[model samples]
Target: MAWRPTLIFTIFSTILTQSLAKGKSDSPICGILRTLPNATSNYSEKYCILFYKTISHLAGDEDSTLYLPVSDALEWDVCDETEPPPASLDIENRYIFVSSENNCSALERASRIQSLGGAGTLIVKEKLHAPKQNNTDYNFTLAFIQNSSYVKIMDGGENVTVGLYSPEDSLLPLSLVIIWFLAVFSVGVGAFWSGKVRHKLYLSEQCGHVGEDNPMTCREPALPHEETSMNLSAKSIIGFVVLMCTMLLSLYFFYHILVFVIIGMFCIASGSAVFCCLQPLISRIPCATCRTPYFNIYVVRGTLEVRQILLLIFSFGLSIVWVVMRKEPWAWILQDILGIAFSINVLRVLRLPSLKICTILLCGLVIYDIFFVFITPFITSDGKSIMVEVAKGGTSQEQLPMVLKVPNFAFLEISNICHITDNYNLLGFGDILIPGLLVSFVHSFDLQIGTPCHLYYLVNVIGYGTGLVVTFIALWLLNGAQPALLYLVPFTLIPTYIVAAIRGEVVAMWHGDSDKFESGESDMDSPEEGVPNGSAQIVT
Candidate 1:
């Protein structure tokens, strides 16, 4: 009779507890385990821990294993879940919700879940893919899981245990700073230096033009000619048309056949770059009878040496393989090497006459960049900025072929300061090409007049490096898309002009008399080739 009384009391107590739990309005849906045992003891059970915000908010190590009533099986698509949570669900108090919507940002998704009685939220994201373009303006406050497999497992409703670790937080590491500064500084200085050397070698191989006051002067008529306003305007129009077409083509190709387009571009650019780099060696070749050095393989039929052909083939093959490998270390290195080489070659070939002209061109480009990036949205029918859209679109997998990227691998844990991500600095060809043209021209001016100061070229190169650093700073501070040329133009132009003025070479350079020689009116001394008689001669 005593044992029967004890059994009846125990059964009554169990029934009372169950009824009270069902009636409670604030019950934990996921359930709470207040006293967590050793890690080994909990291995047999499937569970997931809640992630707290930061180290400062941590009360103790004991709170690390807290869980909630959110079940792994109750994945909700807020868009599809138009109806409110049913009364039977009773997941109001302690449960969080999960969302992976592509329509909105992580912050917006979290806000929606919060409105639906979720105490917390988790957003699943893919690696290297940020919020969509429209959502980039807002910073997300929710925790994002990057592991695709883990997200799938959690979303699949499998009986699995998940551990949420706080994101590893760090500042801009010293290793990233050094690597970024060195890469920018070296590329600027090295490309300028290589272009100067190549220019000298190119000038040396030309016959009848040796020791000319200005090599650019030898290819034009004796009479000086200036570009008319109409001519300049026409050139502007043509240039704009070509540039727009190229941008459209790039945008199209990038989306459709990214790997193939990138491979082709790399091959063409790197191949030409390698050829130009070998110009010095090619200039050393001696003709059997004439015993003269040759400057151009293009001008001389069948003049390409076997090694030069082989080198071109190898460079192209490597470029193709690198693209096929999706830019692995081997391919990445090749890309950077070729990018530098291409930059040097472009610097060597492109030229601007004077600081005044350089300033004017740069200022105009600054406006172009700014208008496209900031003002286009207001003017467009769709109210979307073309520059920002292009930067965001076709970038789903992080393969931007239009821009050359140099990865910072010096410290595996550090993020490069020039990047929004933890990878590399993205530099568009326009960033290098336009400013580099003027730098190369200044170098050529140095060679022509033999200026003792030698400060114009050096100061201009330094100015360019300074401009690049400023660009990085602007990108970080704005936390949005910036037209790099806006900063680049001012930084490059002012320092260069100040240095030129300080050296008292302003008039000489502005007039471009330093790079020209007074020749006879007779046509006999006229330039043999299509080279201009003066630095500023009209292209026509």
Candidate 2:
């Protein structure tokens, strides 16, 4: 929130901006320079003008025209007299085709606007090109001059553009840097704080309707019907579909070893959850009194405990180690982090009808994120900075942007300086799918299988939706979309996280055994009951 140097630059740029909204704003730069307001202030502000140059902001836009005045007093109207020849005579000697007219006799014939008393100024018109293909302009600024005195006479004749314009110098690059920082930094920090506050409330909760000793006495369960049987819930069907999808994703691995590893992890998660889900049902069914040791099916949920979950997370670090050990660039390693983080964040919040719905959505998000990174839609560089190619039409072919190759992985340049974090790739449909499914597994998990937090069923849903909407809005704003949506709409799904959290406080209530207050017994079965006196059971 504190004012910074970027803010200072914006204020300074705003001072120089001048615009005549009645003229070029309507007619564009091709027509005559119409009458205007104070051209200095109006144009300066209307078009972002700044003195400071940084790679962080230099990546140009598709249609931006950069006017670099070689000397302040040079006439912008006639590059024929004002704009100098190549800085080095050797530039023209060594490179035969340095000038735009060097190879085009027709173009040289067309540059004869002098016969009509109209002087032409060189203008470079840039178009999108892959990095190593047709990119000609590569200098820091176009080597050209502008003249105003002869501008009015140049409208009627064919003119040659003598300027070198690079696509790297685009329109209003990072125009509202300060504004974006103020907005996103404020909202990101604010939302993060809000999440913390809600988490605190969830952690420090107290029992309400459900008594610690007996939940049965506190009115009938809200979904007692759901508690009656396993009943092949919609969630189970979803699991099957997701599992199939997971198997398919396993095929995407460049190496078969990676496939086994990923699939093995998935199976571990599913196997553990399934085992836990069925424990209560099996416990309730009567078995003939046979002293067969094999019939004793004792369910163990400890391996999937919270600490164990944390351990599982730590295990993922091994992959990072392997990647680093392979001597990959830091960016690629970071892409992994980013890809996982982005996918998880999105999946944690999307909504679906059933637990299975979550599986599909999460898988979709993951696949989309990863695939996009691999084949991201930007040009790549071949170990050369693109700022020195002003030798004119005979320069090397330009490659695609944002597709630079690295030692092993790719850099995935989202922009010149700002990229897709340390470990992620481009946004693609399949990348969205796989990760979406994995995240869905987390969202769709039925905690009611054993834990005292069935309220998460609703709370997690709301949280999932809210988190998703928030993430999308954040991404949209980051990608130069309108930033006001987050304020205008409140995500109702966020309530789910809150509700699930409050349920956490009442955990003791749901986990304990039926008591005198719960079962309406004057005295409940004491420690001397057939089953363990106080352990809670999952009937569904």
Candidate 3:
């Protein structure tokens, strides 16, 4: 066991000595890391050291460099080892292996290269999601080059010089950790508080008395029973088909137009939310004898307050600034504020009353995610994983407005070399919104039954947090892009269902029944109808 590392060091040392005779003191050639016709020219270097920039395997600045002349390996089906690449005594040559196959794992290819006496191996994966490499106890250095750089290296043969910049550090940024916790807590609080407020509003609407002066104080409103309707008429089906076609064509021809349209919608929604929040304060301002309050001029969807109008103006100003300046940091902050508002509103309005509905929807999505991400490649000759390609390409050039990037607090100070580097974590809204919906449903369920302290909401939120933690662990452990919903859907769904079953409420919950009130009721003042003493009975 001890001899293994020693043997590797010896081999590396031998390669370095051989490369030194052909080497110079100059730095490696600089080329932009991309693949395209206009990509930077590649430069050949007699000596180079491979660098690993991942979170777990960070090669330090002071690590020893092994100099070897780069050489290209002949293209072969690495999956079928029956015809392995011919072995050579040229241990001084670092090999580059390119493959588009799905059968062979990256580690397997690396191990095979080491057996063939490669000083180091560079794998150029054609697919978007590369195979995971868990075992680092290899005999030689290895690096995974992605996208355009791979093409440049392949075309340049031994002449391409590639460089990888070291990240701030291997440790997760403290600000990132703080932001993540705050996001989860805020989503939870938003969902719970909004649901409770909505419940109270529904109570007020159903019963006429809204003020403290009302006499019937003890009376509680009937639990809401939403109507579930399915209108699959021919006209509806035709309308759906037309809408889809229009969307596809619009996205194809006018992608930027769609982007601006979405921005406009976000402005309107954010403005309305700001107005709703400030309405009560705006109403208190006294107006002159016959004239209306100044805030009345601002009203659009409702009696919009002056501050709310200002919020809309500010939002529009920020959008304009982002377009003109292209200041990425500002765009990041503006997107974050808008994204949070969208999430809260979605959680507030979207309701899944039946337990059966939540389970079926989430479970179906889990299978959908796994199939597209992991299994589709084998079934079809698709060049890349659909989900991986979408996620990678969607964020940058296409500029798909699918995610909100949290601002890295560490980057606030302007310094050449600050230890507190910005660690902006870009998370897709679907990752937050989907689970938020389920967690919101559970909290609303708690409200419906008059449960104290939102017990079920806490459990389901814990399940969501656990699932997300496990998803990250799997990403590191697997060393590839994973469908997050593959882990999340099950973790959130199963535990909450178990909790419901244990309390003997699964049957009633599955059918969207409430135990505190009868199946049908119109008024809260009936002697038979009112708030429960404590927790309601768990109806089977």
Candidate 4:
């Protein structure tokens, strides 16, 4: 178990090193280009454009609106001509489109367009470059558009008018609030349920060891085979991270072919997760006690209760239905439900043995996330982050199922124009599961110490929520994707360590003395004993 943490850390470090070595420069401003609704073009209505303002003061406001008609430059390469083409009435008050492959710079082209009375200049290019800034004063907005957009506009003819606007921020706050609630709920419930399961397992183990002279009869309770939690080792954590990197790369490179495979895997995993979530609740029903005859199938080890069997079939059936109806407007609801269940189950099954291991895992993953989200753009062939690309499903029509997505509920006409009508605010499962492991650990620790109120668990959960709020604020301010764990790791780990230190239990928490609780005497006479300390054994 100790090896998992080390393995995860090493993998993250390797990814960071490789990304830093191949880094390149990027433009400061990338805005959205949306075609008006009345356009006759058959092309995509929206595009991502890199904008540069000639007026230094206007640089601060990327979201400022610029609505103008577009016109082709007299010369395809605006820089090829020595003097601006004969001024035409058609060019005045319109955006001039030009090829960027010409020898002249973007500034020179913008100056020529300004001289021609054009409202703005749109330079078309296949490759991106940082436009050289000049001190000379000019009064026009200049931007670079992909050749694809230029071709589409040209094909659409004169009816295609475009506008530049920043991505919408209206839905960010609401979406973040919802996500925060879901994450907190998942962690709290998972920790509580995990503690209960461990206590039950401990009691069962104690009952099994009762001596012959004891009057009490020992009867084994029917429990799930996967009752034991797997503690993460330092080396296994490194291996796990390495595996994650490999999987990310694989998805990026082979998404077209592998997307179906990933979808199938998600269905299976989500089905099992759903079963795990529903089993306890259904089992509490009196009718659920009915059992089916024992079967000799190698996969199923013991006789399953009637309700458990029905629940398993129903869970799988739901996943299948989701897959079939995934393109429907209401499909996201099912996806979110499946995703939340999966995250909670993961937090319950995976254990971080100590605070030290938790710190290593969180810190390593933060660096890994930062590299992929912020740094990989410079290194990848396309000027896009590998993490974002994979999350967006690359060229595949099917999105990866590892995120919780909430659609923007706020109504805005611009949202439709920008082709964001169906867009969703996304939070990856990693964001929840990684920090959640620490929350789970502290809750178990609280039980071991026999605290009156599980102080560490509550504090860390609050810290996670605060950190998530900060992350959303950063995203809104920067108007870009942020590395959430960068904020989460500090907010969660520091406060937890401070609490432990104040109580003078730093050493105990560091090494996870809770593991020793398993050897403590069990009170067989009292069935109502509180949760015991130590790792829970998996009953086979």
lDDT, candidate 2, 255-341, per-residue tens: 234433433332232233333333334455454212211211232211233333333344344434433342343543333332233
Q: Give me the candidate number with maximum TM-score.
A: 4
Note the Cα lDDT for every prediction shown.
Answer: 0.46, 0.26, 0.48, 0.66
Q: Model 4, 347-418: lDDT tens per residue?
A: 666666677778777887887788788898999988899877776666667776666767655423334443
Q: For candidate 4, report its TM-score.
A: 0.67
Better of 1 and 2 by lDDT: 1
Task: Give the Cα error of residue 266 in candidate 2, in Å.
Answer: 35
Ranking, TM-score, top scorer first: 4, 1, 3, 2
Residues 432-511, candidate 3: write the lDDT tens digits.
Answer: 65666578767777887876778778887787777767765665556466777666667777887898888877886676
lDDT of 4 at 398: 79
lDDT of 1 at 313: 68
How many steric overlaps are in each model, in order? 6, 78, 1, 21
> In candidate 2, residue 17 scores what lDDT?
12
Q: What are the runs in model 1 whose C-alpha is more than 4 Å off?
A: 1-161, 165-191, 194-265, 278-301, 304-306, 327-330, 393-400, 407-424, 513-540
For residues 1-540, could you state the per-residue lDDT of candidate 1 as single tens digits? 111221222111111110000111111111111322233344323222222232112123323744444432134554444655545444443334354554555555556666756544555444423332221222222444434433444443423333332223124534336434544553465446644653454344342254365555443223221110011133453464345535544553454554445446555555555655665565466532232223333312223444555555665665566566753544556665666665555454444445555666666566666766778779778886666555544455544444455554432222321122425545665666566656765666676567665566677777777776676666555546667666666766677668768878777766552133223212223334532321111110
For residue 323, what is the lDDT in candidate 2? 34
Off by over 4 Å in 3: 1-58, 62-165, 168-179, 205-299, 319-330, 379-381, 394-396, 406-425, 513-540
